[model samples]
Target chain A: MFEHLSIQLIMGQLLIGLINGSFYAMLSLGLAIIFGLMNVVNFAHGAQYMLGAFAAWFLLTTFGVSYWGALVIAPIMVAIFGLIMERLILRPIQHLDHLYSLLATYAAVLIIEGLMRQQFGSSGMPYAPPLRGGVNLGFMFLPWYRLWVVLFSLLVCIGTWMLIERTKLGAYLRAATEKPDIVEAFGINVPRMISLTYAFGVGLAGLSGVLAAPIYQVSPSMGSNLMIVIFAVVVIGGMGSIVGAVLTGYLIGVVEGLTKVFYPEAANLVIFVIMIIVLVLRPNGLTSGRGTST
Target chain B: MNSDANAAPLLQVKDLRAWYNESQALHGMNFDVRPGELVTLIGRNGAGKSTTLRSIMGIVRKRTGSICYEDEELIGKRTFQIARKGIAYCPEERAIFSLLNVGENLTLPPVLRQGGVPDSELLKQFPNLRERRKSRGTLLSGGEQQMLAIARILRTGSQFLLLDEPSEGLAPVVVKEIGQLILRLKAQGYTILLVEQNLQFARLVADRHIVIEHGAVVDTLSAEELVSDMGRVKNYLGV
Candidate 1:
């Protein structure tokens, strides 16, 4: 296997792996955050990501907003959308079983995807790459936009980690995750915190979509296509562990990429296989204690 | 203390009724706590002593009737709104955040008023907590968790405190320490409503004891009266 593979091929696949890993990390991180605090599976996350791409495209074409502007505006728009969804739909059903939220969000996925398909059609739309140039690093050519995605996502991940793990507000969030009523009794306005948290998580999904628009096609099915893989990533990482979600996402992406190079047939199957193995071996997940204990 | 006796009640509960879903927990409960007073709600397990505190804090949402704090009705207010009006609750379970370290748990509650006990003073008071500041909530012993629960609320600057079962599962020495801490808080003029199954512990720190049986106050006894009627009090506790 090694003898037939050139250094250039391996490097190219590695870069692709890193880019995919960045997406996995961002999507799974959002999922973990939402699940951790709100106890909602957020099935519509992929739709929100699609919405981000469409939002960016809409901004660019309809209003002449540059990619730079859309990059910031799109996620905010998705967050506002998420805020409304949480307040109107999720909040009322919050006290019900976990299944209710799952169904509700799944309904949202159908509705959002249906609306997008009706408007944009099933075909992929091309979004021009913000940075067209590539850099040669001796082994392979690296697209500037792809490099930007990896670095920018990594920065966002680090910043989120710091915010959740290091700050006083984060302490409130962690406490609320465990006991929202007690947190409320302490005058922290836990309901408002919960609403904002869900919005923030979906905002990450939107940001991921914007980053992916230049790389992958912006289509109605784009988010749903990635949703299953992202779910597999969340399961492999553990349901609510922030660190587990992020690290496992990147790890799975790279593993899948490597499989594509060595054995293309197993590329798609690798993540599910890993998920089964992880579930059997470490049922509580790799980073259990760092997340909500309940 | 005599002057505080004449001061208007800091909290007044009148015909307060609460339910856990379909089952009622508090039945026409009534009590009052004066400024600078340390009161204890003494009852058996499942006697709704804790629920009374929770009802006052608005944790039990199915509650009705009146919970007046500083003469303002609290029955309709949300928990956070009630909390904002200078009342703090330390739940029976301690409810510490396992993900947060000792230091974070110590300062988790927000200060609702101007006179919150400073973090420096609280750390000094609970020196053990200071030493294990970086350790997670699960790392603490039962007594330390209880201490952390009580200490955290002190920083809220809420003159009124509701503590549930602080000495429930602790060793004799730790229970004495908690009693001393309660006395210290009382000395500093912080009004507290404590729930205790330990009749002995109640006698140690409380100025008055409100006996709850079947979710209603059956008797009110001062410290001097409680000491004289030890046999009846122990009988009520079934200990």
Candidate 2:
């Protein structure tokens, strides 16, 4: 007798996996960009993501902001915070050893988290989904918000890729990764690019947070634990490569989902397990990766 | 003064002052890279040859000078903006994006020049790249990577190309290959500013040669004068 796990159950897991993958892809891609070219492990990424969720929650609660408004305003606001961090903090540490950047970001994460805790307290608060109700798939019930998360996140990811890979600004960004001085010589201001790149990258994480608010409990330390999994995803994807981040994010999420079906215990550890396999097989990743570090 | 049909210099540098941090490199230096001319900034190591090129490119952050590229003031402009106005730099480090393949390295920024040259032109010039088309830049041999770097800029077709010691650490045969490449670029009307210690390569490609000792232009001479005058050569380049 077959253990008849229905198509509905399978589809549900698939949807969950894809949604989780969307956030993973966004988070890890940003991590890859920052780590690859700048060579900084941005420990603040999770905190930044949490800040984004808080932005959405704050806008909604205090200003009666619509989901649409929070979607745009939250990311821009978080990006401004990111811009300040890059200009005031990250820029000064550009030339220091790798450890300095790590320490700097770690300090930033702790401080941001602490400040958020002070203001918001320790409890998690629920936010209503912007896109309400479930879409009826023949096999399963798919939530409209979850579907939006996958679709919108992919759109943003593609948009980012187009910006970085297809445009003149992207050329300079990729070029900056190769020869900053040569790019500088070409009369492209490298510092401004660095700042913009930081802001754009952090902005991606913020957008993910806004998207995540309805799904996740909004709290100060929401970003804290999620970062560990994303780091593993980044490593598995290869550091600093955008495509790799996206791919690994989805693949690992699916694998984790499948693992939950087969063996529940392994589900939580699946990403780290994949990281081990990748380290042994290809230190890089499935793709060659753009100019960002691998 | 800008390049003119009647009487202007192609590029004019007046009191070009530059520094790294507080340590000044170019001290009131003056020079010109005439239209369609190949000029050499010849000097010993730390003689500011490279600094001169960087300063002209507007890459030097702490720089004060009148660098006229055609009619635009290059002093205050940003680096890529300067490049958009028709100037490119090939650093001494041979700063190729090792992660990219040979083909990508060639075509990332299309030639700014209006010659309508395709990447095929680059392949024709350096057949080696075609041979290593799929190879990662890091996988290339020293000579191959150098050729790729130079070929990359040529594809861009920028009016002015600044090449910093393309022959540094290259074999004699590779140096000859580079000399031929530069000559080919010059023939196509690419204005080149070459910084070099390879006297032989400089002699082959340069129409006018100038020496920098301690960041100031100690002497400037035509190629003919350089061939004949031994005093400046012996004093500055020690050759």
Candidate 3:
């Protein structure tokens, strides 16, 4: 299966896989968190991601904020916006069916895309790389920024794990996910937790956008397109555990990468194909988690 | 109503009505829970017992009445916000996060003990939780899960807990354990609102029973008064 592929071709596919893996991991992590804890699948997650990238572009091009500044500000601003959406919009519809929630977020995606189109022309905006050079890894040359994204994403995923699994607040977040009513009965501010969970999920999507801006064009259509692939990732990973999302993202990224080395034609189709197989074999996902499962 | 009782009622519901879209579920339900009072809402299915709990916690849709906790208006608050206002709700489903282990389930909510409830104290109070600390919530026996559910709320330090059907699916021995736990919470100065179908259990544990049928309060009576009128329980609950 691997005979005809050159070592260079193999490395090329693997590196791209890693880069794609970073986004899939981050985006799916956010989706899983929001869905698991707050019981909202956050269809607008990708749009939020695009919004982050565009915010960075707008900040740098129009406001003169540095790429570094936008990296922090864009995610924060979008996160605050998520908080507002939760308070002003999502909270009211919480009692409706899960389908209503899914529709509500889909509407949010449309609203965000419309606003972005009005502000930035329909044409995609280019993002210049913040840090300039690539490091030669004996097998292939790796861009400094691409490597930063992987490492930073790993740190973020781990940090989030620690916060939820080890910290006191994480405990609360998990508790809220399990039984918000029960947790609230304890006199704790569970609504605040819901708002923050949404913010954190949206913020992760924003962070992924900042990382992708230089690599991909900042466009209104970015999130919707990537969302489909990420949803596939969520399905295969089961959207239950944070680790499952991140790990399966990278694993599938590599699987797709390996396929490209041997047969480039199959690379794009592999994720969806795998998603179908997984759904058939284990519809509940790789993790046996219950509650708001994607 | 006594001296040194200046603090507001722990929970107060006035003409609180709730609906699921167009259908009304709770009709002008009026009730109050004094500090340290163990309150139970007892009624047959479709009697607005669960709806009253959901409406008070802001988990139900289309609520149109007053829900005040410590004199603060709770009508507009979200379920989580109402929870933040010092309330915890355990649904009738026992919706414990199934995948999370017993310890994880207990630890998930913010267990801040900043002049609030503490987890260690709860573990101390419910030794069953500590004993089965490593078990998954779903894997635990029904009684154990119920105990863990109660323990989870206690861990958060919320003195007021809205527990729905803690005894509904448990074994007889487990039901007895639940009754004991309710008394334990009452003894510890915690106020509880329970929706119980186990009349025997309710009679053993409840401080007061507020009976409802078709969304309106039909009766309020003491535990001793209830045993004497098993006829009423048979009429209202058909048990």
Candidate 4:
């Protein structure tokens, strides 16, 4: 491996891998949380991410909002949208089979994607990076914005993990996920907790979108394009395992990045191949059955 | 025993009918638990004894008819609301969260009122749980899980308790311990409606027993009457 590749090339690919991993960690974490508590696959998650990016773009163009402002506001707007969707559409069909929610959220995806395409067209829109400098790390040049994204995403991911694993509210969530009716009998408002959980999960997707806007082209199809890979990430991580989702996300991202460096043709197909391997060897996922702990 | 015959009933269920989808689990359940009384609902398997407790907690959503707690209607109210009005439930399966530790399970239910037993007292009452405080619910034995199910609700300060099969599948010694615990709870003036298949255990701890068959109350017997008519009670239980 060292014979063909320079240190700079390896470092550069690794940095790119980490950046992609950050998005994967955030998006898959959202998916895992929603699926764990709500039992909904949330097929509309990709659309929600698109909506988050668009919300940021719209805020910047229409109201002269800064990148900082969009960061704070866009996720909140997406969360509100998630809250409404969960209450009006998902809540009614909650008693139905998992396929029902999958289809319903898929329908939402089509509707949202159609509207965004009509409004913004299929072309990718450019969002200016907030930070404009790069540092020479001796091995490779690193962008300050990329470093910020990776660090910030790590913070958010760790914060969320701690919130779910350590806090009192998290205890309620974990307990309710196991037995909602029993938790309700304990005087906890479980239905409300469920709705809020869905909202928070989408809010995470929205945050990921804002982070990705400056790196990737913000477009109506950006989220859907990335969604296939995200589903693969979730499967490899396990369906409802929170820690599995987060860890598998970053791992797959790095693996894909390394593949691009070593075997460029297999970069796109590597994660799916790993998914098949994981499915064959460990059907429940790598970190499942630990009982919600990482 | 604080059994005042003229005192208003704390909980009154009149003609309560519940369904699980298309199948009816409870045809019509009628019972009353007076304040400070330890009542038991005794019946054979599939006799809707568990369903009756579920109906009271509003866990069975398709229930019709009235469940009045402290003279307030509870049929249309949500489970949490019913709980907020000072009622707690311990399910048959001891549905403890396997993800949570014993301590977390113990304190999971919020304190609904000020009179709830503290964590220290609950640990003292079930000393086995004290040793397993850091262990997850999955790590607990059958008796420990049952103790956790009953112990968790004590912190809620709910005067009314709906316990389903607290002694189910436990050792005889553990069952006796549970019976003693129930007697202690009764002495503390907590109004409990227990669903038990073990008539001997029910007779030991309960002040009154309501015999259920096919979702309807067949007989109501005081502790004295239960002993006097043991043959009739055995017939109702099909033992």
Q: Give candidates' CA RMSD values in order.
A: 1.4, 4.7, 3.9, 1.2
Off by over 4 Å in 3: A1-4, A38-43, A62-64, A84-126, A188-191, A218-225, A288-294, B1-16, B28-40, B64-91, B107-117, B155-163, B191-194, B206-208, B232-236
* Model 3 lDDT per residue over A8-69, tens place: 88888888888889899999999988987877778999999998998899899989998899
Summing lDDT over every window of 10 consecutive residues in candidate 3 chain B, give the lowest-scoring window.
B1-10
DockQ, all models: 0.71, 0.38, 0.36, 0.81
- Isolated chain B TM-score per model: 0.97, 0.93, 0.90, 0.97
- The interface root-mean-square deviation of each model, in the order shown, is 2.2, 3.3, 4.3, 1.5
Return whichever of 3 and 4 wins on lDDT. 4
Per model, state how many residue pairs clash. Answer: 0, 15, 20, 0
Q: What TM-score describes the B chain of model 4? A: 0.97
Candidate 4: list runs displaced more than 4 Å. Answer: A1-4, A292-294
Task: List model 2 lDDT by residue over B118-200, tens digit each.
Answer: 78777887888899887777788888888887777765557788899999998999889889988888887778899989887
Docking class of 3: acceptable
Tell me which of candidates 1 and 2 scores higher on DockQ: 1
Q: How do the residues A119-212 of candidate 4 rate in per-residue lDDT, one tens digit apiece? A: 8899999999999998999999999999999999999999999999999998998888788998999999999999999999999999999998
- Give candidate 4's error at residue A69 in angstroms: 1.5
- What clash pairs does model 1 have? none
What DockQ was computed for model 4?
Answer: 0.81
Our model 2 lands, by Cα RMSD against the true structure, at 4.7
Chain A (alone) TM-scores for all candidate structures? 0.98, 0.95, 0.95, 0.98
Q: TM-score winner between 3 and 4, please give it.
A: 4
